[model samples]
Structures are given as structure tokens and as C-alpha cells.
Target: MKFSPLETPLRTIMTPGPVEVDPRVLRAMCTPILGQFDPAFTTIMNEVMEMLRQLFRTSNRWAYPVDGTSRAGIEALLCSIIEQGDKVLIPIYGRFGYLLTEICERYGAQVYTIECEWGNVFAPEEVIDEMKRVQPKIVAIVHGETSTGCMQPLEEIGRACREMDILLVVDAVATIGGTEVNADEWHFDGVIGGTQKCISVPSGMALITYNDRIEKVVLSRKKVERGIQTDSDRSILAAGKTIISNYFDLSQLQDYWGPRRLNHHTEATSMVYALREGLRIILEEGLTERFDRHRLHERALIAGIEAMGLSLFGEKKWKLPTVTCVNIPDGVDGESVRHMLLHEFGIEIASSFGPLHGKIWRIGTMGYSCRKENILKVLTSLEAVLVYHGVHVNKGEGVQEALKVYIEQSKAIGAGR
Candidate 1:
């Protein structure tokens, strides 16, 4: 028996998330470690928070990274704000929506859901109607549904929630840097994001932020626990019979990131480095330009795919630019095509989930992977794979159509400049 030092394969990641990380960020993660509370390390933490605020386009003082995956951030936000028997409404647009509902239910909150078809987003009017009927204390929705590659409309919904005096919690795990999301302007009460999606970093941390209104709710709660206080002097404690999971306590997390600097757990130091550098890249490129690049690449990919004779899965208006869902042609094994792309071409794409599984393939134009070259390569490889599966299509037409889209977009961007 023998073992070798671990090595990871290099593949062009076109999957929905955890996209190909930049080499610079990978190098940043390899730097020497430091004590979590060391001055240098704390300085790095401060920089990370500032970068995240810039990326999130929010002025909220509570912005910081949670010590686990994106779902951890979602749980922390929900478990903290949702008291026992509080009414929580989740609009189920995809699998992640159901996940939000489940997390709220675990906190003993009464979970109610308004469902939309898999490939569609809810209209603001529809959500307003639901809010009137449900009158929920909190309304949770996904800004970009990774499962179905659909972007839910948030601005109008946020305005409606504000008028109704209901808190809005958004899961922007897939949209944050890849699209336009203005937390403060949208009147979002709390928003959660992740590093792996648009930030182009390895996964381990989740960024969460809350406005002052939500802070007031946390302060008003009578529950108190023994922990360091946060900036608002709110105790990091939960009352009631059952203790919500201790590891995910937001109050304590807020304290640790705030002035107190209390120890919660050892932070993921390497991931922090990666996240900071990833965010630096975003700021360097300018968030709006990054977003426009994503849109341009997305349009090119869709134009190429459609030119290849495949129809997209979602409504055109609601399709997510970062992750596009395309219907698999009849008689084609979606999994086999994906396997062929990986093994034969070193490209990766994803299969849909649940009911959409085996019916569609998810192709992502995200982070460092979203580029003209990558778009052409994916379309060319996909054409080969599809033809091999007996789905006859023009071999070079997709790339040509994609090139045409790039030319038009280049002209448009030039004119704007």
C-alpha cells in the first residue's frame, strides 16, 4: 500500500458554483498562518469586511463572513431573527427555497410558502398578494436560484415588504458579484452570500449583513446569554426552552467581528485570505464592469446554445445570466454528455435536480470562468458531444454565433465608453 501527496485535477469549471478560482487567490491561500486574534490577522479581517461591504453595496455595519458554507449564513440569519411560532414565508422558486423553509421550521417558526413553477420567478404583484394574505413576520426569497438558474425579482418585492413592515431576507449566494444586487437600495433587512459563486474563491465562508432595523429586533429580545456584547450592546444570547444551535449564534458572531473580538471558533485562515484577495479582484475590476462582463458572456453563451438548436429551460425574462439552464435534446443522455465533456475536454457542467433532473443541463458563466474563450470552448465541445450522441447539429455554428454576439457587444460597450 502506498500514498502520495494530494494533487487536484485542473478542469475548466462551468458548473453552477465553486467555479474556477483565480491563481492569485489560490496563492494567497498558501501564505503563512497567523493567530486568529493577532493584530495582523485582525487587520486582514477588517479589510475583508470592507471589501465585502463594497461588493455587497451596503453600508450596514454588521457585514462579516460566517465561518462555514453559504448555508451556514442562511441558518444563522433565520435562527437568530425567527422566534418560536413566528410566521415565516418562503416563496419556493427552487430547491434552495425549500431549504430556507426547512431551516426556519427547525427554529419552531411556522413556515408558509408560496410556490412558483420551477423555471419561473414570482411577480412582485404575486408576492404582494401573498404578503397581504400571509402577513408573515419575515419573507425569505432567493435572489438567484442555483437549482433552476432563475433570478427572482427583488427590488419590487423589497419595496412591498418595506411598506408592509415585514423584514426581507434574501439568499444571494449565486448572484452577489455575478449580478447587480443593491442591499441598501433594495431595503433588504438581511442578505447572505458566499465566496465560491461569483467571488471566484474556494468555498468555506459565508458573508451576511443586516440593517439597523433587524439589529433593533435582536436588541429588543429579552433573552440573554453569557457572551461578549456586539457594537449595538446587544447580548449574544438566546432565550426560550430549546437552544437554537450554538455554533450558528449570530449575536456571538456579531460580537466576534465587532469591537469585542471575542473568540467564537478558530476562523478558516486560508479561506479568509482567499476571500480577501477574491474581493480585491472584484474591487479592482469594478463591480459594475464585472457584472456587465457576466451579462455579455451569458448572452453570448445563450446565443451560441440556441443557435445549436437547443431551447433554454426557463422563461427568457427570468433566466439567470451567471447560470443558464438548457433543455437536453430528446434521446440524449444528459449525464453522459456531461461526463464526456469532463473526461474528453476537461470541461465541467451540471445536471438539474429533482423533477428537472435528466431533462436539462446547467451551464454556468461565472467568475473567472466567464470569458469569450471559455464560452467558445464550451459551445464547441458541447456540439461535439451532442453530435456523438446522435443529436445532429452544426459543428462550428455555435461558436460562430457566439463570436457574432461578442462582436455586437464589443461595439455596444465601445460606444458607451
Candidate 2:
């Protein structure tokens, strides 16, 4: 039997994650492979760290991408600092928040939680109040809950955590590159980001940054692997408590990324290239500009959806700009519409999870997929599909409203010029 060369359909992905990777990033991934520790490749690694620092808006000494999806970075950070029976506070507003709780529990943390309704985020006062009550060693929260398209405000929580001297860990996977994540000003001890969502890169890397406050805890749990231990390392080996997973150990991974250059697992070369290029694209456009772009597209998408007689699912103020949640119209099969969008239009949008699964459709205007062309495509296609399903929508109104947004922006730019 002979296997053919791999091929996949061309799709316009309008999902919460794994959105379209930028063409530039895809080209970068095709660059010839280099030895992971070669001077040239290491230079690229250092560049990636610096770029990650800029992307996260942090002055952190440690900024790098882990070799797995977004969850890997979250797990590494939690496992490194959380010892058995360490008290942890997780505020769950969506599915990813529960993911943090699960990771913490697996690492033997005694987890405490505060939860709000799925479509709403907790007030800063509520979270701060919980922190005072629970007084956990760490507070983990999601900056953007893509599952419900709610973005929790973090500044107040961060300030409160600092005042209480509890480490504040944030999962900013969905909001990092697409929105403002001031890691330092927000007082986050650590932040984990993903490549696939707003970074316009493939889904193989998880970016992380941590200030010295978290570093102190990670260093306290450091243990050097015996195989690669130098004489100096041998002296300090096992001096502190050892982290549970060797592969996910932040302490050991640091040495490999640090000047000591101790060998850990081989790095994922192509993904690093993709990440570097992705970061460069973001920096080239500028962070503020990129954020504005995401917001602009999101506004257009929302305008179109609302004009077509659809209702948005989450609170307007707390809604995530990258992922928009639209209510599934009454008497329409949400999944069938999605199927029509995919099979008939070659467009892919996501459905919600758990209670929201059939009640809402998640449309993502994220990363490279967040643009005028794709937003219009989704709006027009969705309107057509809804009409086919016998839903009464304002014919042509969806595209019309979306075009108004774009036209207004263009006029504003012209006036500025």
C-alpha cells in the first residue's frame, strides 16, 4: 500500500483557538532546521525571549516558550511553585479557570475557588474579598475566558495580591498579543500565553514570563539532573526541594535557556522559528496597533451579528474582543448552521462547551483571521445560512452594518491624514 502526500482543506477558521496562522509564520516554519544548541539557533532563542518580554509588556528576566500547547506552560509554572498541600485560590468564570484548578490539584495543591456565572466575570472587589477570606499562597485566574467570551479585569486583583503577598499567576492565552497585558504594571508574578489564538502562530508553543517574586519560589525547588550536572551543579543538586516532573521543571529548563546551557530535552526548532517570526510580525505592527486592529475587527463582527437579529451572549463590558459569543437563534439548530458554514462556505466557527454548547456559537476574529475580509465573509455567510435555516433575519443588514464600521474607520483615518 502506498500513502499519498498529506493534504488538508483550505479553511477560514473562525474559532476560539487555532485560528489561521500567518503566512509569514508558516514560511518561517519552513526554514532549514538548526542544532538546538548551535550559536545561531541559541541567538534565535534569546531573540524569542526578548520578543516575548515585549509581547507580555514585562521587564521579567525569564521569558520563554515551552515546547507544548498553552496548557503546558500553565502546568510548568504551577508544578514548579506549588508544593504538596500548598494552598491555591482559583477563580472560575469559565472552563479554562477550572483547568487551572485541575492542574493545581494534580500537583497536590489544596485548591480553593470563587466562581461567578458563566457569562459574567467577578468584580475586582469580589475576588479581593475572596483572597482575604481564603488567604491562599497563590491566586490563579484567567485573563480571558474564551469558553464564554468573558475577559476578567485583572488590575485590581493584581494589586490586591501584591498587598496580600500572594503570588498572582495569570493565564492570558487568549488575550496576550491581541490585547493589553501589562505584566509588570498589573503586578502579575507570572503569565502564560499561547501561540495559536492571537499570536497568528501554530499551536505548539506556550509563552511564559515571570518576575523575581515567582523566580524565588522556583529556585527554592530547583534540582539539577545528574546526567548533565557539573561540579558546581553537583554541590547545589537537591539542595532545595525537587519539582515533581523533570520534563516540566522550570528550574532545570532555566539552566538550558540560561547561560549555563545545561542540556534539557531538545528544543522544537520549527516552532521556535514560527514563534520568532510571529513575534516579529507583532512588533513590526506594534502592540498598540495590533490591539487596535483586533478591537476594530471585533467591533465590525459584533455590529454585523447584531444587525442580523442575533444577540450577543456575554456582558458587553466584559466580552472578549477576540472571541465573540452569539446566541443561537430560537428554533435553529446551531450545529447545523455551523455545518453549513463549514461545508458550504469553507468557514469554520466554534460551538460553546457544557451548558453553552448548543445555546451559543463562538465566532473568533483573532490573529491573522481577524481582518476586514474574514469578518465580512463570516457575517455574510452566517446570514445566508441562518436564512436557509428559516430564521427571520434582516436581509443584507449584517453585511451592511459591518461595512459601515469599516467605512467609518476609513473616514476617520482620512480625516486624521
Model 2 TM-score, all chains together: 0.96
| lDDT at 10, model 2 | 96
Question: Which RMSD does model 1 reach against the true structure?
Answer: 3.3
Q: Report lDDT (CA) for all predictions.
A: 0.89, 0.92
lDDT of 1 by residue, 133-183 (tens): 999999999999989999998999999999999999999999999999899
TM-score of each: 0.95, 0.96
Best by lDDT: 2
- Where's the lowest-lDDT run of ten residues in candidate 2? 233-242
Q: Write the per-residue lDDT of candidate 2 for residues 1-417, one digit (tens) a residue.
A: 999999999999999889999999999999999998899999999999999999999889999998899999999999999877888999999999989999999988999998889999999999898889888999999999999999999999999999999999999999999999999999999999999999989998899999999989887656344443577665544443346788889888888898888999999999999999999999999999999999999999999999998999989999999999999988789999999999999999999898898999999988999989999999999999998999999999999999999999999999999
Find the 10 residues in a row with the least total lDDT in model 1: 233-242
